[model samples]
Target: MDNDIKNFFKEIRKLDDNIDIPAFEEINIKRNSPRKEYYALVGIAASFLIVFSLFFTDEKVQTETNDTDYVITLSDENTTNTESLILEESSIYSWEAPSESLINNFND
Candidate 1:
């Protein structure tokens, strides 16, 4: 088996030596459109305009003042007629675990 494998590899190596491989070629990629540069300049100009408007603009805000007064008057007779509220008792609920005897009765 070893001799057969060695003979197979020798044949493969002889075939590999006879095969021709291609040579490497240098490729140069260049941009053919100037729209990318124009877009970038436009974006930069827009950012600068926004920054200048936020920092250099001077605008005054005017607020109006209201001097009107509001007065509410309550009658003494209406204040004296107040009624009391009555509440009824409600039942309370409690939680308890099952006793050992109950568990044993169920198991039986």
Candidate 2:
């Protein structure tokens, strides 16, 4: 088995070395390297489009419903404020009334 392996390796080493693999490989590498520049250009274009959309795409987006005055409600009738109600209650209870409350409601 050892002798068979050595013979196979010696036979493989006898192959022609005049074939130039370097030039073909150099051309392939150069051709593939230029794709990096194309990729960079595409990246820049995509970034610019994203930025432009964020800033300029919607200057004034008038939604279909802009007439919603939802925060404030207006009424024509006058409503009683807390201060005025307290004042009125105080004035009513301040009068001298008969001591009918002294009689218990449980009696006749």
Candidate 3:
């Protein structure tokens, strides 16, 4: 085994050194990272859309025309009030507070 390994390495070392390796070209694809302001704007827009839809959505319940004496209803308008209350409660939570320097220099 030792002789075989030595023979293999000697064979490799004795190989011609005139072989040329191809140069690799660098790839330069420009990557666009999302900005903080863009994310904030998108978040604000989505929140407004959700709130608007919740506030303006119709509270009507549709009944099936089948003769089976079973009617399925989501809730008796109680869920709507509960959802609104939840949204109101969640409004108390906010993003990180502004930097102290920004707060102090608000007039500037």
Candidate 4:
């Protein structure tokens, strides 16, 4: 396994050495246009104008009063029925080993 991996890497290195790589070239970047800057300034001014108008505008919030009234009445007839209920006692369970006759019955 080690010899196979070493031979594979040696082949890759020989192939890499045989290939010709190109030289690096310089890249030229142009400056930003004045029209784009003007548009950005106009957009910023429009956003600021919108924010200031929202803060300074006079807006009246009208609240309506609820005229309907609600009344709740509780009765004492439903509170006197808990004394007639009956409850059963719970049974306790214990584990027991099986008998030798029960095991012999299964074997037959």
Candidate 5:
């Protein structure tokens, strides 16, 4: 075990001495200033539009909901409309009530 350890260390030292490290190279990564500025403006506009739409939708929904009478009126109108529809489409099956003579015959 000791002989193997010494040989491993000797080989490692020789490899380190023979190995050469490569020089550092800079990557020339570039961004167009106009494109960066345009993207920033687009992000700002998108955020503004989202906020504006939220406010607009909230206002519209409030206008619809603020009038409690309209909701009540609509509910009342719907109930009456449904009732009228039921009455209009209703069918009645009529039959004459059985007389006492009919009962007497069944007993006989």
Candidate 6:
């Protein structure tokens, strides 16, 4: 590996002995100036528009008034006794469990 590296460098030195290299040139460019006042003017205009809209906007609230009165009575001229309208215990049927036929209909 040492001999191979020495031979490589010797060949590179023999090839580079007659070659002439050129020097690098400097580039001249002019940069444009930044527009700081235009950016500040746009920001001030946006802030002024936001503040102006907040001051000029209006919100109206609506209110309604109900002046009518409602009267509720329990006993009139026709309804004299309330005992005839009472319900009995046997007249109200109790709840029971579902039958087997009713449960089988939902399985389909």
lDDT of 5 by residue, 3-105 (tens): 9999999999999987776644434555579989999999999999999999999999998788754543353554554434454433445544569679889
The TM-score that candidate 6 achieves is: 0.23
**Each model's lDDT:** 0.69, 0.68, 0.66, 0.71, 0.78, 0.67
Please, what is the TM-score per model? 0.28, 0.27, 0.23, 0.29, 0.34, 0.23
* Residue ranges of candidate 5 with Cα displaced over 4 Å: 1-32, 69-108
Residue pairs in clash, model 2: none
Per-model C-alpha RMSD:
22.0, 9.4, 29.9, 24.9, 12.7, 18.5
Error of 5 at 87 (Å): 45
Relative to the true structure, candidate 4 reaches a TM of 0.29
Relative to the true structure, candidate 3 has a C-alpha RMSD (angstroms) of 29.9
Model 2, which residues run further than 4 Å from truth? 1-27, 31-39, 42-46, 49-52, 55-71, 76-108
For 1-108, candidate 2 gives per-residue lDDT tens digits of: 699999988877777455556776677664446789899899999999999887664543433234453456657447545344444454666776576666655465
Tens digits of per-residue lDDT for model 3, 1-108: 699999988888778456665554435554555687788889999999998877665332122324344768776766565444344443435745659678779967
Name the best candidate (by TM-score): 5
| lDDT score of residue 11 within candidate 4 | 96
* Alpha carbon deviation, residue 95, candidate 3 (Å): 85
Better of 4 and 5 by lDDT: 5
